[model samples]
Target: MKKTFFSFLTFFIFSFSAFAQNSVADEIKTLSKNKWQWMADKDVDKLDKLFDEQAMFVHMGGSWGKTREIEIIKSGFIHYKKADIHEVFSPIIIDNTVILLNRITLLAVVGTNEVSNPFMVTEVYVKVNNEWKMGSLSFSKLMGLN
Candidate 1:
């Protein structure tokens, strides 16, 4: 009886955790998609609201921090076009936070050049005042091979 009860309890806990992880991942996807749209539209207010005050962004090309990100947008040094996010993988959730690590490929125009590449990104979200807010986001270009 003891063995059977322990097995059931373990299964239940695992199932619940899996479900919670999936739910958080879905929310992350929705939020990220919306933020991307805001970026495309050059809506700084929306972006500011989406990101937490303590948010840290480590972008490709060795850039970091939220201020730099805003500068990039405000300066018009980077632009996203025809962007499509697919093949998301390795979503890990802890407590009320979610971390989405995925490979993203996009068509980008930097200044006057069009470039497309697959990049690895890790986006973190935390529940703040009953709302999920992005805490930190980092992305690095995947090199080697096609």
Candidate 2:
């Protein structure tokens, strides 16, 4: 009786853990997709709530923290016109941090020129005050491979 009960308890715990991880991953994926749209629309209010106070953004031109990023969006310096996301891999969670990777074709209007490029974007999210907030976002231009 003891062995049977212990086995069932262990299995239940493992199953719950797996479910929790998947749930978190799904939620993060949805949030990332919405973020892309908000950026394209220049919805700074929504972004303000999503991005952490010290969040950092990395782009080919340069890297900056939350304030600069918001300024760039508001000023239309680099309009994230569209993000053609090809793939969003399963998130990797560690402690209260989640790392997500996405392969995408990005279309943007930088200054007076409109450009499109393939890139791999890495997004990091950390749980703060029971809410997930973006901590870092970096883009890596994909070489010739497309």
**Candidate closest to the true structure, highest lDDT:** 2
Against the reference, the lDDT scores of all candidates come to 0.77, 0.97
| Residue 30 in candidate 2, Cα distance off native in Å | 0.2
Q: Please identify model 2 stretches exceeding 4 Å from their true place.
A: none
- lDDT tens readout by residue for model 1, 57-80: 875666566777777767767776
Model 1 stretches with alpha carbons more than 4 Å out = 1-19, 144-146
In model 1, what is the error at residue 50, expressed in angstroms?
A: 1.2
lDDT of 2 by residue, 51-124 (tens): 99999999999999999999999999999999999999989999899999999999999998999999999999
Best by TM-score: 2
Error of 1 at 136 (Å): 2.0
Per-prediction backbone clash count: 0, 0
**Model 1 lDDT-worst window of ten:** 82-91
Per-residue lDDT value at 40 in model 1: 76
